[model samples]
Structure formats: C-alpha cells, structure tokens
Target: MANTTALLFFSLAAFAACSPSTCTFIPSTNATTTNYPGSSFIKTSAYPYNISVLSEVPIATICTSPTGNRTAELACARIYIDAIDEQLAFLYARRLGYAAVAGASKFATNTSLNDPSRNDVVAAGMAAKVLKYGATEAAGAVMGGEGCMIYAALKYEVETIQEECNNKFTVDVERVCK
Candidate 1:
C-alpha cells in the first residue's frame, strides 16, 4: 500500500512539472506626444521591443481635407501598419517559444502530438484584437467622413496580419515541432 501511494505521488508531481506554459498577448498603448506636430496622428509604443509608429499628418487634417490626398492618407496608414507589423512579429516570436515548450513536453513524455490549430486560433485572435484596437483609436480621432480613409487602410492591414498569423503559427508550428 505504501509503495502504491508513493508511486501515485510521483506520477502527480511529474505531471505537474510537465504542464504547458501559458501564452499572453498584451496590447500596445498610445503615446501622448508626437515629435512633429503634423506628422503623426497616433503614436504607439510597442513595449519590450521599444518600437513605435508615428503618422506623418495629423489625422484630423487628413480626414478633413477636401481633396483626398493619397500621399497623406498612405503616410498615416503606414505608421499604424508598421506598428501592427512590429507588434505581430513580437507576438509571433513569443508564440513560437510557447510552441517549442509544448512540443518538447510531448516529446519528453512520448505522447502523440496535439493539434496546433489551438495555438493558431489564439494567435490570430490576439492579432485581430490588437490591430482592431489601433484602427478604432485612429478612426475615433477624426470627425465625420474623414475617418473613411483610415478605416480602409486599417482593414487592409488587418487582413494582412491575420494571414501572417495563420501562416506563422499554424504552418510554422508543425514544422518546428516535427
């Protein structure tokens, strides 16, 4: 009886040690000041990475200008898009690390590989939330019809990041783990 109890305790301890680690995605925050007055509409800091994106024209001006200036509109889009790209890249790397841990745990225990779709779902969801929040913030800063351009650009950027998330976590995780 004592030997069986000892074996049971050991199994529980080993299982606890082998549990998978959790992955978290924290969204970036907007900074209050822009170095150039008219250059950027929104400035955000990608924490831990020390990266930031700044718009070229004040978002209000871009929205209110009678003639839709493609140059200014693209410039504003570029900053937020760039920020989204950087943030996604950071999150991807972190997700890869988590996948590696899970993979290693499976291998150590001689367990069948678990489906990676779960991780992909989580990564994609987080990426969508981050990009959407950034876009919403940018659109909120402009009044009336002016926000259309920003929204359009943001939509494209979001699609691009979502694709990237699918490729990175879904496809890449399998390759890395195998």
Candidate 2:
C-alpha cells in the first residue's frame, strides 16, 4: 500500500509537470473602478496603457564554409536581415496593440490573420505552387511567393484593426503609416 501510494504520487506529479496551460500574450485589461462623490455613475476603464511582447531575434554569424564561405556569408546576411525586419514588425504590431502569433502565421499575417485556417491554407497553397510550378523560375518565383505573405498580413491588419475599434473611434491609417 505504501509503495503504491508513492508511485501514484510520482505519476501525478509528472503529469502535472507535463500539462499544457493557456498563456496570454496580452496583459489583462482588468482595472479597479473609481467613483467620485459628485458622480452617480461609476467609471469603468482599464489602465491607459498597452502591453506588447516581442520574440528574440537570432543573430547571424560566419560559420566555417561547408560549400564555400560566399554561400554561408550570403545566407547569414539574409537571416540577419530577416530577423531585423521581424523585430521591426513586432514593434509596429505592439505599438498598434496586436499580439504576435507563433509559427509561420506570425510572419505571414498582418494582424494574427483573423482566421487561423487562412494562414494554413494560404501557406500550403503558396508553398505547393512554388515547389511545383516555380521550381525553375528561381528569383522571380521567390519574390512572388514572398509577395503573397505580405498580402495576407496586410489584409489581416486592416480587417482585424477595423473590427476591434469602437464605433466612435476613428482610425487614420495614413497617420499610423507615417
């Protein structure tokens, strides 16, 4: 009975350790209500602030050449630039009160892409077409493929932000873009 109890406890502990929990990317909006003696109604508002979290950008390094240093240097430079662009986008999203999603969707969407299915469907279709039809096209094909991702992200940002705004709120994309 003692051995069985110990085993059960250990199993439970292990299970708890491995359990997945929901993590909030955005901070909670709950705020304490303030009331004035003169006012009959109470004020309900969250803190006058926005919270944002960004992912760590990886650094580029020169590694010993497996296929000439030129290839490695170009590859490293490309990854470094990509990381810089990703960080810039993260900052922009955070400034606009958007939470970054994990995986390819993060890069592929303008604003969490609204529909999760859209991310997968679009990515799969684009990747397949690139592989099948654009295999010989090389540079042009790559640019076209990347263009699709930008289009998806732009669409998401426009739709999601518009949907999130209050009826009275007015958004000036031009101002924001500036």
Candidate 3:
C-alpha cells in the first residue's frame, strides 16, 4: 500500500516534471504547440491515463494486499506498467515534435542528461532494472517499497522514448504532428 502510494506520488511528480511540451497537440500547426507561460503545463497530473482493460487501478487495494489475489494483482501492475509505458512513449513522440518546432530545451525542465552522477538518474537506472526484470517477477516492479523505483522507471523511460521518437520523427515531426 505504501509502496503503491509512493509510486503514484512519484509518478505524478515525474509526469509533471516531463509532460509540459507535449501536453496537448494543437491542430494544423506544427510550429505552434502550447507555450506554457512561466514553468510547465501539468495537464497529465490529474488527467486520466486511459488504461484500457481495467477501468480504475486501485493500487492500494488490488496491488499487494490479501495474498489470495496475487496473480490478478500482479497482472494489474503489469498492465499499469504497459499503459504507463505507452503514455511515456506518446509523450516522447510529442515532445520530440515540439522540440523540433521549438528549441531543443524550450519548455523542458533539465533537458540535459549530462550529469550521469545525478541521484535521480542512478535511481532511474535501478528503476529500469526493476522494470526490466519486473516483466515476469513483478513483485518489486509493482509491489513493496519500490514506489521510487517505479517512478524512476517512468522517468528514465522518458529519455529512452524521446531518443526513439527523435529517430523515428524529427523530419516531419512538425508537419506531421498536425
């Protein structure tokens, strides 16, 4: 329960940290996305993640308590991971497009990953491993005292997704984004 709660909190924080440039797609204009005046647009912090199969993920309830539903709970977490991954991928795609039209670091907070020694980056790596092996085991991936790890996974996944989207988009990210 505590772990899932932490994961939710950190995930929200991570999303807020990285979701500015790609919050909403402006129709018919690649050159203009949303220029959030001041800091960043935190649209996703409260927006629904749009998980398909399950309606609402009661992370505290079905995640780890009442060992009888372990299988379902684990499945629930894995599904959440996938959904979160998809959202991250989508955010990456849009951010790439926004960066192309806008500058590389216009709306992004700490866009540079130069400082590999950063604690968040290291913990995100740990989160990555948790995500990697969590595919099957899934205990630490979704349950237990791994909220920060899960949040890191989401955080680091943004970088990876951004690179992938850059390679895949960039050329027409501006035009095609419309």
**Judged by lDDT relative to the true structure, which candidate is superior, 2 or 3?**
3
What's the lDDT for candidate 2? 0.40
lDDT by residue for model 2 over 1-178, one digit each (tens)? Answer: 9999999999987654433231223322222122221123543232111111232333343334666778777776765565455445544444333332331233233233334345445445655666674354343333333344434445544444334321222223221100
Ranking by TM-score: 1, 3, 2
lDDT of 1 by residue, 1-178 (tens): 9999999999977654434332222222222234322225545453222343333213334333357788776776666556556554554444444444444444445443344354344434544554564655323333111323223323332333233222222212222211
Q: How accurate is candidate 1 locally (lDDT)?
A: 0.40
Off by over 4 Å in 3: 1-61, 102-178
Superposition error at 27 for model 3 (Å): 12
Task: Tell how far residue 131 is off in model 3, in angstroms.
Answer: 18
On TM-score, the candidate that comes out on top is: 1
What TM-score does each of the candidates earn? 0.34, 0.23, 0.28
| Highest lDDT against the true fold, candidate | 3
Instruction: Give the per-residue lDDT digits (tens) of candidate 3, residues 1-178.
Output: 9999999999987665446454332222322334221114324333234432244533444466476777787786775566556554544455445433333342234253222334334444545666775433344333312343333333433444455323222221110100
Candidate 1: list runs displaced more than 4 Å.
1-66, 116-178
Error of 1 at 126 (Å): 5.8
How far in Å is the alpha carbon of 29 misplaced in model 3? 8.4
Per-candidate Cα lDDT values, in order, are 0.40, 0.40, 0.42
State the weakest 10-residue window (summed lDDT) of model 3: 169-178
